[model samples]
Every structure is written in structure tokens, then in C-alpha cells.
Target chain A: MIRRQPPALVRRAAGPVLYRLARLAGGPPPGLRRGRDFAPADLPTVVVVVAGADEGSCAEVLDAVSRAQWASDAFTPVFVVDAPVLSPFRRAGYVVELAGPGGLGAAVAEARRSYAADLVVVAGGRGPEAADALTGLLLAQRPPIEGPVGRSRRFLRAAEARLR
Target chain B: MSGAGPEVGRGAPPADDVDVLRVLAPDEDAAVVAEELSLVAETGSRGAVLASSPGLPEEVLALVRRGVTRVLRPGEPVRAGAVVVGTPRPEHDLLAAVESPVVLGRAELPAGAAALLRALDGRLPGGRGNGPEGPDPVGPGPVAAGSSGRRRVLLVSSNGSGLGHLTRLVAMGRRASAGTDVHVLSMSSAVPLAAEGLLPYEYVPSAGDLGISARRWNVLLHRRLGEAVRRFRPDVLVFDGTYPYRAVAELGDRFPGVRLVWSRRPMWKPRMGAVQLGLVPRFDLVLEPGELAADLDRGLTVGRGDALPVRPITLLDQHELVGAAQARTALGLEQDVPTALVTLGAGAWHDVDSQLGAVVAGLRRVTPDAQICLVRPSIARSGADPGHGVRTVSAYPLSRYLRAFDVVVTAAGYNTFHEAVAFGRASGFVGVTAQLDDQPQRARWAQREGVGVDLDPLDPSSVARVAELLVDERARERCTARCAQVWPGNGAAEAMAAVEAVADGASGRELLGRAGASEGRGGREREASR
Candidate 1:
């Protein structure tokens, strides 16, 4: 025999109960996540890093990196991506690499060691939880990356003179 | 030089069997013919003497021999391959002797003679077919029997302050060339007509050098004009404006056959001294455009017709206006704004400044939204401010800019006034110079016909009145329509016909007789007296 459930009781039980479960479990949604970031210091050379889970996620990472490189000053870009994302970056003419699953912290450190990097940038997160965690870790280490704030102001001044 | 009739050795070669030869003489026609004949003979060719007559004066014969190769008398037989040369009279026996040969005459030769000459010279008849022998039929020798020849007219204009008279005469000369040649002998710069290819001209000493002023220059010019008249020997002589009266007198005496004409477009009282009037009768004809014929004294008036506009209104093409637009755009004007053109014909020592001020004020009031282009004779003296909706340009080619205007406000210089009328635009006339005797009359006439409005420069109210009228759409339309009826821009054709009639010695007497008959008419008489 099938037992009939009361709708009002079910609705009341679901919200608070799920919230407590998720706080303990700490897992993200099932969709693949992808991200990338770039900074160009030498006008003709750019640097990029990307992270993703699946092929589609890796493709998204590469596309984002390529667009950033094209928009920046004309440059040969160096890319560090998740192992699965490297093939697409390589096809796109970037000096590329396979990053292990620990995300871009090690990649940023390696880029600084291997190439005399003028800037360092980070991008992509599985979700808000993972993004928040990665940002917190990056803040603690403070990689030797030159930020875009001062450079953006200088570019703006040059652009303004050209317009006049 | 190969084929010949009876061989006559040189040393004033006998006029028996030769076609023609050049010799020096005072007679220019004979000299011209001799020169042409010499050119043909120097080419080393034999030509037939198709016709000869003792009636050709010895002076003319002597002139012809200087260039002619082999001139043949009436009964002389021409060689088989000779170029037959002679007059057009069919009775000449030498024409029958040659199978086909080149011929000579004062006018173009008859088509039949040209055909015959071309055939005998081993050239195709009609100058189009192939020849079995001799050179290809490049063209028929100048068929001189009936060809319409050029009748050269010389126009002498003074370098006076205004170009009104000179401009009008230039138009007349251009029109006169329909069946004749025209050469202008200007004392001033030979206007832009040369660049336009309208008339060929040369410059003489300035009118000032001809003693036109209160000084001794008039006497010097009188003598110089006489010398020029003797030198140019025109078929017809035209004196534009005044100060060439003594020259006209001298031309009458020196060149008795030449028809001496004067083109007068003055609107003011004659400032010419009393002695000047005595010389007026010597002119063979005085051509005045429009009702001006009525003003000329009896017998002096030879032709009366619509005067040709001094500026070519219809001739100002779209390209000229487009160029002006581009220029104005470069000078920083909004290309879309309605433009108004204001001009005062080269101002004399009159109330030019005051007149210009009134026009500026009126233009500002009427065209608050429009750009005003003031074409000043002297931009420095006019002192118009750019802030008052006015831009002063020194001497714009007015006809080119006239097309850019919805309306033109100007003084009654012959050229400016007619340009407005010809282009079918609304105009306002500000009478500034009493020296231009025609201005007041033209202005009144234009007003009556509703083609233009006349503002009295002396009256402040008149300026305001014109300013108010400028904004009236109906008034502008009415004026433009009326102008079309009065001056349809064919005055040049009429003037040409009148000139042709006079030059042909046909219509001149009738025109003069009509003028004499109309003497009793009080209206024209009154205008003349004024």
C-alpha cells in the first residue's frame, strides 16, 4: 500500500534541512567550470594561465585566453593550462604547458621562475566556493605579478593624446 | 614647279601663264592673297591660272605676284597636271582649258569649280574619292569663290573705373562674330572673354594715357587712338563708353569704308566736356540696347535692339557653382544654409559706404537664419563685420555665386543688374551713383515689372522697406516670374542680328530712320534729357 504525503510538510522540511547538509558536505554543482586570466607587460609579449575539468571546459579556457591575447598589445603569449587544455593552446600558437590539478598557484610560480615575467594573473574556478578558496590562497602568497591598474592609466593617457 | 604653260623666266615674272605670286602693296586683301599664293608655289607645284581679269587693279596685281607661281591671262592654256587658279567668274577662258584644276577667288569657290579643280589635279572629285596620280585628296584647296570670309571688327574700350561699358561691348563683339571675325583693342585689360574663347583681342595704351583726365593725357590719348585706328584697319570699329570720340573721328577720316559704331550704356548725366559732343556725329552708328536708342541724337543712332547682358548668366555652368560651394565650405560655412549674394558694382566716388551699410542691415534683418555673402568692390573700405550674419569676399566671380543665392541684392551696374534678370532671381537695387545715368531708370523699370525692388540709398525707410520685402515668399516668386518675361536672356541674339544687319548694310538705315521718326515721342526724349 502507497502512503500519501502532505505537500505543506514536505516544503517546510526541504529548505533548512538541505542547507545544513550542504554546509557539512561542501560540494559544487555538477556542470564543468572553466576560467583564464592574462596580463601583457612587454607590449609584444603576453602571459596567460587557465584551468578547467572537461574538454569543453578546456576549450572555453583556451578561447578566453586567445581573445585576451589578441586584445592586448601585439604579443607572443605564453600559456599554462590544465593538462587537458594544453593541446588547444598549443594549436593557437602559444608557448603552452600542462598544469596539474592544484590550479594556477604553482603555474604562476613556475612562470616567474622560468620566464622573467613582467605580470602574473589568475582566472577560472569550479564555482563560487572554489573561487573564494583560490583567491584566499593567492592573497596569502602574493605572487610577483605587476597589476594592470597603473599600466591601464598610462595606456589611457597615450590613447587620449592620439585622439586629440 | 614641274608642269607649266609657256615658260616665263623670273625678274618680275610676266603675269601671263602663272597662277599667282605675291608682291608688296598697301591693299591688305591683295597682300593676303599673294601670301597664300606664295605658300602654294613654295611647295614646288604647278597650278593653273583658271581665271584672270585686267579689272583686278594694278596695285592688287602687283601685290598678288609676290607669292603667285604662274599667273595665266584669259586665253592661256593650262598644263595637264597644273593647279588651276583664278576668280569665280565663269566667263574666264582659262577654266575651260584645264580638264580639272585648282582655282582662286575672293570668296570660297563654287562647289562645281572645286569639283572640276580636284578632278584635273588627279584628285578625286568632291574631295572624297581616290586619285590614280598625285597626292591624296587631303582636302580641296580653300574654295575661295563663295566661302563666307571673316569680317574683322575692332572694339576699343577705355580702362575707366567701371567695367560696365567694356563688358557690354565684349558681349556685342562676341555676338557679332556669327558671320564675321572680331578683334578687341582694349585700353584696359582684355577681360576673361579671352580665356572663355569668346573673342580674340590685343591691348593698347591705357585710356588714362589717352588724356582722359583733367590733365594733358586726353590729348596724348587722342593722338594715340588715331595712330591705333590707322594701324588696325578694322572693317568695323566699336568704341565702348566715352573718351574715344577723337579716335572715332580719326577712324572716319583715315578708314572711310569702315563702319564706326559706339556702344553706350551710361545712365548718368554726361560729364563729357562740350567739345566731346561735337565729335559724336562722326560715328557711323550708335548702338544702344533696349530703349536707349531713343536717347541718341537723330542720324547718330544706327541700330536699336535689346542690349546683350555684360555677364553671361546662362553660361555660368553647374561646375563653376559647385567649385564655389567647395571653396565656401573650406572657408567654414555650413554647406546646407541658404546663401544671399549682395554686390555693388565697382563703386565710384559716390555714397558707396552708406549704401553698403544699408544693404548689410537689411540683409541681416531678413536673413537671420541665412548666410549673407557681401561681394564688395573694395573689401578694405567696406569694413563689413562677420558677426552681423555677413561675410565679405573681395570680388567673387559674381555670375558663379549668383546661382547659389535665393536672392541677389545689388547696385544697378549693367552687368550685375542683367545677371540677376538673366538668372531669373529676385534682386533689390540700391541706387548709389548718380554718375551711372542708366541706374535709376533701370531700377524704376525693374520695379515696375516686378523683377526687382529699388531702394533709395538716401532714404533710411527705403532700406527697411526692402528688408521687409525680402522675407515675402510671394514677392520673390513674382519678381522671378516677371524677370523671365522682361529679360529672357536672348538679348545677345537680338543684338547679334542687329549688328549683322548693320554690317551687311541692310538694317542700319532702317534702324536709324525709325529712331529719327520716333524723335517726337516725349517719353524717350525725356529720358534722354535726364
Candidate 2:
């Protein structure tokens, strides 16, 4: 999907204010532990949203998160999913929170409120394809893959490349 | 040694309670004491020698050579806050003369002197009770000796044109004593610190990188640095950059306990960087990495006594580099073929494509089969193709593989300039225009010293001339021979000693201030004698 970014002036003025406001709005979930003492505090937090109790999607997203390289134990990860799928992620030593009754939007909001992640990767499918897409989103957290393709096409190309 | 009774010396007590130590050594161990005193003076502390004879002791003269000029009359009353080191004598009791903070016997010679040195280094906590006959107060003072005594140091590097600032800080961080814990917070993207196991490294984006205004970026810097200061609780904070950010200067007032040292490299563009020099006094120490072209230095910091001078700091020592064949294999260049490495810095600050093209054309024209390797700086925004036969190799501290190339063509930045000469590689220097660095002067120094030829990128003839020298065997020998004659030993270890001293308690401001005052007094005394 192609999206237009806000003007540079607006971003320059509002970025820090919004960051501070978001930081103040929510914090890590009640029992969610802080990262290790030496871990950089500015690492982009990650929120993985998995719909329903689809075990395949949960497993795929979990696998992608485990393999990503943002430094060993550097970023904070919060998985928002159906209550039934929470055990696997929890057993994997990740912070797992059950999605509220209000569905996807509410689940994302609650996760954001709990972890304040900078990037969100949604997992809604049930195969290796979904995991590949999740991996592309994770890679997009960097300055977006540099190449000859259009901005929208770059992400899609990244996803396609990962699939192959 | 005027036989008069003890009288106090000029100057008030240091507010931080660090005493200007007076060592009264007996005749036998003077040489050993002199060696230790030179190390102490190197850390930015003045050593006072109490002598009664007309001729000074070897230790006292050694201290003078290290820029300490304070001499005390034998019977001068020891001032308050001055620690006394002397032998217990029958007629004269040095301890009983005045209320000394701490007195040491000669039996505890070097070890006792070392403890006092550590105390002066600011490694010890302030306001510990040390009476006239105190139990060795220097024993495990503030920063102790064992594993528990490891000093936490926070090194901050700014995003300069290239990795000059970050490289210098890394040199110090890697060479720091095992008892020091180092954390780096850099604005440069290519920190490479975590790879070295210098953990807890953080990257803060530069204002240009963030597309933000300098004002707002400074605000962000203040918050980020303040947060790091609180979390790291560093005993010493070292910043290496031309401009000491207002946020960094403010750190002193905010965290009084954290000793701040500014690792400032000199050879600034003449009359440039004066505004930045105003912040030098704000720091506890201004560590000036000595420039090879010191005589040619026309910059603002040229005559400044405030900064403690150390040898030119290079990340890799000469011994650390591999042999030519080994380096060639590592870089994948074939043996017996001429190769030249062109690293003109990151190309982010200034575009070097036209210059790079000229060099390639020149090299190909002179030596067709010569492998031309360009260093793809880690911080460069994007890599451009350098035509055919030229490959890009990335390496941290490229000095490690410097031997692989017969000739190195580079801009005269602090790190690359020193590394090329110190490693004794034949080189051509292109003086790139920089914000504050005096690159042209460095290139001129190289030419004058006969170590390298200065080339102009825009001038095709000059590029062709240097390109010929690159493949010429005899020219290469002349350059390397001159390099051997001119290269000063690596100052990384000495620079680390200064940092450790400042981390312990030696204040650059106090030491330099006293140095200036003492020089002033000596000037007046010489005039009176004349």
C-alpha cells in the first residue's frame, strides 16, 4: 500500500512531542520486565499482533521475531494475541498479553499502551507466506531497503524476496 | 631549603580536597621516585619537591622536565591539605611540623606513593578522614583496587565528517585498564564498539540524520546524554569532538561527581574553533592529541597551556599490523601486483566522485594491472561504483590491512594521516577542506617531512605525478624511510594514563592553572635575578 508521509516541517515540530506523549501515555505491562542493564534504551520496541487463536500464524510470527537481528536481547517485544496462543510465546520467554474483547484495534491499542513499540507487524494468515511478510515488516524498521524500486514496491519486493 | 621554620606556600586549598602532594624523598631511591613522579605529572598534577641543598635531586629535576616547577624550602611550613612523604628523622619531624592530611614513611615507598597518586587522580572519594598519623588513607579509597573497584567510564563521540572522533575514543576505550568499564554513546552510525565487546553502546542520530533543527537536536542531546549520565553513573565522561556540545559542558554542573574530560584533537583551521575553545575551561581536562605538524600549527589551540598534550593517538600499533603478504591475502589482492588503497573519508560530508575518478584514471594510465581498492566508509550514505578493476573493501581501523597496499591515497584526517605515517606506508595526501581540521597543513607537513607527496584532486597533472610515485619502487622506499625517521611512538597508552588519572582525581584545570601560575612566578624570579 502506498502512503504519503507528513511534511518535514510538521514531523520536525511534532515528532519529539508525540514521542514524549506516547511515553507518558503508557508503560510496560505490570509484570513485563525491563531489558538488561547494558541494553540500549533507544532500541525500537516491537509489537507483534496475531489475530484469533490461529496457531500457525502465532508460530510463524514467533519464529520471525526470534531470528531478527537488532542485537542480542536489545529490543523489548510484546506479543498481543488470543488467550489460547499466549502459552507458546510466554514459554519462549517473551511478554505475551491476551487480546481484549474489542478485537484487533483494541488489542493493538492495549499492546501499544503496554509496550509503546515504534513498529507493528500484523500476522493474520496461517502459512510460511505470513511469516515471510512478517519478516519484511521487521526489516522495514531499518531505513527501508535501498534499491531502484519505488518506495511501496521496495517493501513488497523485500517480502517477495524473503518468500523465495 | 632555607633553614627557616615551616611556612605556608601560596595558593588556597583545592575545593575538592585533593592536596598538592609534597614528596620529600631520601637520596637512595631518587631515580625510582623520579620515574613515578613523571607518571604522576603526566596525569596533570604538579609535584612539589622539598629540598634543602643548592643542587636539586634527580626526582625533583625529573618532575621539572615533566613540567612541574614547584620547589619548597626545607623548613617551609607544610600547607593545609598537603600530604607529606618523608623519612622519620631524629631532629626534624616532618609530620609534627604542621597538621598534615596524611604522612607516609620511606619503607612504603613506591606503593605508598602510588596510593597518593591514585588519590590525586580523583579515583578516591572526597572528604575521607585522614588525620596527621592516619592509617594509609590511600588504601582502597573511593574507587577500590579489586573487581569491586572497577571504574565506570562513559565515552561520547560526536558525528564529525568521518570517524576521527569515534576512532580516538575507541583507541582509548580498547586500551583502558582491565579495571575500567567502558560504555560508548556515539552519534556516528558506525560505532563498531559492540563488536569489540565495549558493551552498552548507544547511537544517537545527528541533527542532519534526523532532519531536525540544531536547536531541537541539542534538546534531544541534552536529554539523551543526561539519561545516560544517570544510568551509567560514570566516574569519568570523555567526549572527543571539536565542538564540546553545550549539553556536555552542562554535565559538570548537573553531575558534580562525574569527572569530565574533553579529548580534543588540535590542528584546527587557523582562527577557526575559537568559540569552541571557550568551553575548554568548563571541562576538568582538555586532552589534546599531539599533531605531527605541531610546528606548523597556526590554530587557536597552538599555545594553549590548558590542554595536556599526549603523543599522536592511533588505534592500531605498528606491531599490530600483519605482514604485507598476510594483509594482501586478507584483502584478497593477488601477490606481486601493485595495489593502492584510496580512503578519502566517508564522502557524506563532501562529494569525492570527481576526485576519485581522476585517481582511477591516473592509476590505470600509469600501471594498468594495479589493483585499486577504495575503502567504503561504513558511515557513507551510499556506495558508488568505482568503474572496473576497482573493488570496495570495508574494514574498521583500516590500519590493520595498510601493509597490503604499496601506496595509500587519502585525505589528511587525524586518524588516517597518523596511521599512514606511523605504519610507514608510502602515501599521497589530498588535503580535503574540513569544518575545523587543518588537512592542508597536515599534507604540507607530510611533503616537507619527505614522508609523502601532497596531491591536488582537481589537478590532473598532480594526480598523474603521485600515481607514478605509487608504482615507483624507489619513491616508495624514500617515503617509508622518512616515515621511520619522523614517526613518534603511539601515544594511546599515555593518553589512557591521562584518562585514568583524571578518572581518579587529577583535574586538568587545577594542574594547568598551577602550571601557568608557577611559570609566571618563575618568569618574575628570573627577571629579579637578572
Candidate 3:
């Protein structure tokens, strides 16, 4: 199980906090892919949690972000999925780690604490316009958040303040 | 008459004592809880029903586990503060149970049962005074002044390799509906088909897919099962599965009013062993859906004198089948071209698409004019393009369009096998993986009975064999003739009658063996007269 855990760099971005929360929600079932180095650790992590499944398209978003200003190892863009979509990111040569089974709120809260997340982005659901705005702000490296970002920002703000 | 109804529900809502929950014990008008909760569910009301079983009925205890209704001791205070029916408390103060329990002085439960039902209904969000409500009136169907009457049948089925268990439940539920209201609770994703077949159904989702610990899944299932029982207040609960779950025993002992019938199919492979057999006696009755291979059955669970065996039950009726020309037009094939429906059943669950693709592709070569249609409609929805010029037709009960095809190539599943034989549609069985149901055994039986052909689905030449059998008029006619001789179209009716008989207190091996009626009906009738 330790061998399957995220690499040292990923462990740095995602503290043991997320695993504890997932354990409470009954953790990922057997065979669910564990953390595989998703984003770089040098930059403050920007955890992107996909609320609905459709993780492939979202992985493409992360891939696009990494190619642009985000830079592979700059700001860690950890994807928090309900289920895993590791292969697409792996194929695209982007380091995409996953934390799951826990709902989005729990995943984002833990991400904020573990990474001192500079921003948390939620995108890819029913609203297309909102997804575009978040995608734009994220690629452009906005603050903890400003565009159409939803509830996770409040959690990140509080976690950042508490850390300070 | 409802004076003995057990009440167990959760806490009362704020302010109004009438804001109670719904729990149904054996002696109570079971639909009363469903009727009440259906309202609360609609009105967004949140609370539980509170009632006490001084005798502590097993039925009431089970409801407590589901948190459907709160159970109280004989003298314990009612928590939900719902209606006080009859003389439940000869010892305790009703006022202590709640700020104001609805206790009617000298009010006969037979008389107040109506008002008690209405009081709970009136407290809902869009009550008579609150706003305009929908068509269904809240309470139990307006009972005749002195009659404690209402009948709800609960049909529960476990997931099988295919729709066999669920389809049989659907057949039994539809037949049971002729005399009683029926609701189905299915543990398969295909549960939506129940609604399409015109039965009210709830999908519990198969536990196998949850990826959780067994203990946790069991607890969740126990609570869900209890809640379904409480909501439906079924007089008869038919659990149709290969092996009975562990909770059925406890549930049976508690709900004395619910006549538990184990609606099982025959053909359990000898290797499955007798572990499930030990639990059969826990049910009020064991219903075995008769198979063509009863004589060949080495299954330990079914076919004993203690179990009732009816004709092979199927969801399709002969009269309901679409005419070949109409079905052909609907399916978009020319009348002149031969059509073969490769209805492999839920074998699609396995990674057999590539294998089936080869079989169908091979089939298209043998019978060039034949239009091949794969029966896995869900494949396209799952985004798998089964593109070899074989379109996917997803119509429910595929039996409705049985006439459209000259032949059907399918898995050796009970529903498909029974329907094909019953409808006299020539078919060839391509055996699929089944954990307990021995499809291979049934496939051989079907072939020997002259009703179908069977072969290993993966065999390279199996497609040619299947295509040849379908195109051969003589072979197809022989198969159809054998089918016509065997199917009696009485399985569902006989099963329903037997189930009702169990509810009416009929038991013993003699009663069970009487499943095949005196008229020598069912397949026997087909041989003798039809």
C-alpha cells in the first residue's frame, strides 16, 4: 500500500489529510488507482476537483494548463475525481494524481490544508459558460480565485488563513 | 378490525403532534404507512412514525431496524406523537409520550383508523388546507366502514447473470396485479424495464458493484429491505433470487402478515451445493418455476415436495406479440430479407463483444440476405460502437418483437429460453458464463427437447452452425413444433394462484405438489389438447 502511495513530491502536495477524509467516506474500492504524480510540487498546488464524471475532458483541461503558463512542475494541479482517469493524463505526459470516493467538498478542504492551495478550480458540469471562465482564470494563474469559482474557494481561504 | 395494528416510526415534527412518521407492523393496515409516507415524501416532510407493539411483534422490530417507525414498549411513551389507535395503552399516560398524543376517548380503532390516516395526511405541506394536492388521496384507500381491506404485493429480485430473476418477478408481479396491487424492488440496473412493463418499481442497485466492505453492504441492504417492506406493507413478499440473502429469515419471522415466498428457478448446478437449501424452510412457501429439465435437475434447493412447481414462467404472452410485418417495419428491415435477432441477453456484462462481433460477422457471411441485429441496446448507450453492420435494438422484453425474426441467437438464460420456447420462435443458445445457473445443462435440455440448439459461443464455427439452423425451414419448423407441444402459457397464472394460496394459509407438501392443476393444464394441456 505504501508503494502504491503517491511519489514523495505528490505526498508533499497532498498531506495525509485527504486519505483520512477518504477513509471516513469508506475510501476508494480495491483496484482504484492510487496517486501517481499529477502536478509539480514547486508551485503552490491548485487542486481541480471534477464534481461529475467526464474526467477525460477535464484531464485535457489540466493537460492544456500544464502546456501553457502553469508549467509541468510550477503550480501543482492535482485532480480530485470521484473515480480515476489517470491513463489520459499519463498518455499526455502530464503528472495527474487523484484523491477520491470522498465528495468534492471533503477533497477540496483536505487539498487546501495539505497544499496551502493558492487556488481551487471546479469546472466541467452542466454550465459551459462557467467552465470557460474558470478555465481562463486557471490558465491565466489568477489568485486563490476570482472568476466563476464555486464553494471550494471559501474552504481554501479559511485553510490559508488558519495556516498563516 | 385494525385495532391490533403495530405503530413504529421516528420522532414527531415540531409543534404538531400529527407530524409523525410511518412504520407498519403485521396486524396494522400496512398500506397506511405507505399512504402516509408517500405524502410526507411529496410534501418534503421529515420525521418518523411512532407506535408501540406491547407484544413486540417480529414485524415491528424489523421496522425499527429500518428506522421506518419508532417502536415503543407497551407502556412506553409514543415518540412521534402520531395517532393513538385503539387501546394500545392500558397502563401508560399518552400525554407523557408527547406534548399531545392523538388519543380518542372511547374511539374504536376501526372508526378512528380513517381519521388517524387523514390527520397524518392533513399535516403534510400541501394538505387540504395548505394547497392543492395531487390525484392520489393520502391515506389508505377509503376502506369500507367495517372492512380492514388493502392488499400490496412486494416482489424482490436479486441480480442474476441476466434478467431471468427480475423478468420472472415482473411476470409474477403482473399476474399478482390482477387481484392485488403490486410493487417491485429490484437489485439490478435493468430495473427501469419494470416501469416499462407497467409495474411500480424501486431500483436498490446491485451490492456487487458498490465496492464496499461486505459488512457495510449487508447493513445498508438490511435497512433498505426493511424500509421497502414498511413502505409497501406487502401482504406477500416474494424474494426471487438463486440464493436467499441472510436477512430474509429475520424479516420473515418479524412480519407475520407478510407471507414470504421464495420464487426460485430450477437448474442450479450441482456444484453450487446445498448451502442455500437449508434456508428454504424459513420462508412461508417455496415457489419453484418449473423448467423443461425438471427430470434432469440435480439442484438440491428446488423440486422437493415442499416446493411448489409451476409451468415455466415467461413475461411474454402469445397474444401480445407483434405481427411479423409490423415488427419488421418498426425494426426497419425489408419484408423480403430474413432477419435474425442475436439477442445474447445480459452476456454483454462480460467482455464478449469482440467474440460476438466475430460470430455475427461470420453469420452475415453465411446468410448474406439476413439482416443481423444485436439485442444489446445498452452497448450504444455505453458508447461502444458495435459496428459490423449489426445494429443494436434495445426494446424491452424483446419478446414483444419475437415474430420479427426468423430466429434468435441468445444466451442460455431462463427468460430468453422460456420466451423462445413459449413463443415457438426457433432459437440457438450460445452459452454464457453464469455462476450458479447451469446454462450449459439447460442448453442441452433445450436441444434434446427439439426446442433449440446450443453451442459454445466462442467456437469459431458456431456462427455458421447457428446461421444454418435458422435458415433451414425444416429444422426451424421442427423446433417450433416441439415448442408448441411444450408451452402451455399458464406459468404466471399458476404461480400467482399458488402464491395467493400460500397467503390464504395453505401449506404442507401436498399443497405445494398441487402446482400443476387437476385439468392437466400447462405443458400437459399443450400435449393433451392444444
Clashes of each: 46, 11, 15
lDDT of 2 at B194: 25
* Over 4 Å off, model 2: A1-128, A131-164, B1-147, B193-195, B198-200, B345-353, B378-387, B509-530
**TM-scores for every predicted model:** 0.45, 0.56, 0.58
lDDT of 1 by residue, B1-530 (tens): 21221111112222324332212122224444444444444544334222343455453456346534445555445333323222222332234454222121111222232222222223211121011111212221211111245565667777633455666666566566456766665554324332136675544334232111211223334443443444444566777764454545665664566776766543444443345445556766656554321233222222323222121323233344445366555444556666666776443322336556656665666557777776654312345545556776553345755555666778766667777787677887865564435466667767767877777543556655555555676877787778776663434445545555556664445766665555547458779978
Best prediction by TM-score: 3
Off by over 4 Å in 1: A1-164, B1-148, B190-196, B205-215, B222-231, B266-278, B291-334, B345-353, B376-388, B393-397, B436-438, B457-460, B510-530
Candidate 2 lDDT tens digits, B430-493? 8888888889889999988998878854476777767777778999998889998888788888
| TM-score for candidate 1 | 0.45
- For model 3 the local lDDT of residue B500 reads 68
- DockQ (Cα-based) for each candidate: 0.00, 0.01, 0.02
| Winner by DockQ | 3
The lDDT of each candidate is 0.45, 0.62, 0.55
Write candidate 3's Cα lDDT for A33-148 as tens digits. 11243321223345555444354556555544544343323344545554334334434443333432223443344333232333445444334433444444444442222243
Fnat of candidate 1: 0.00
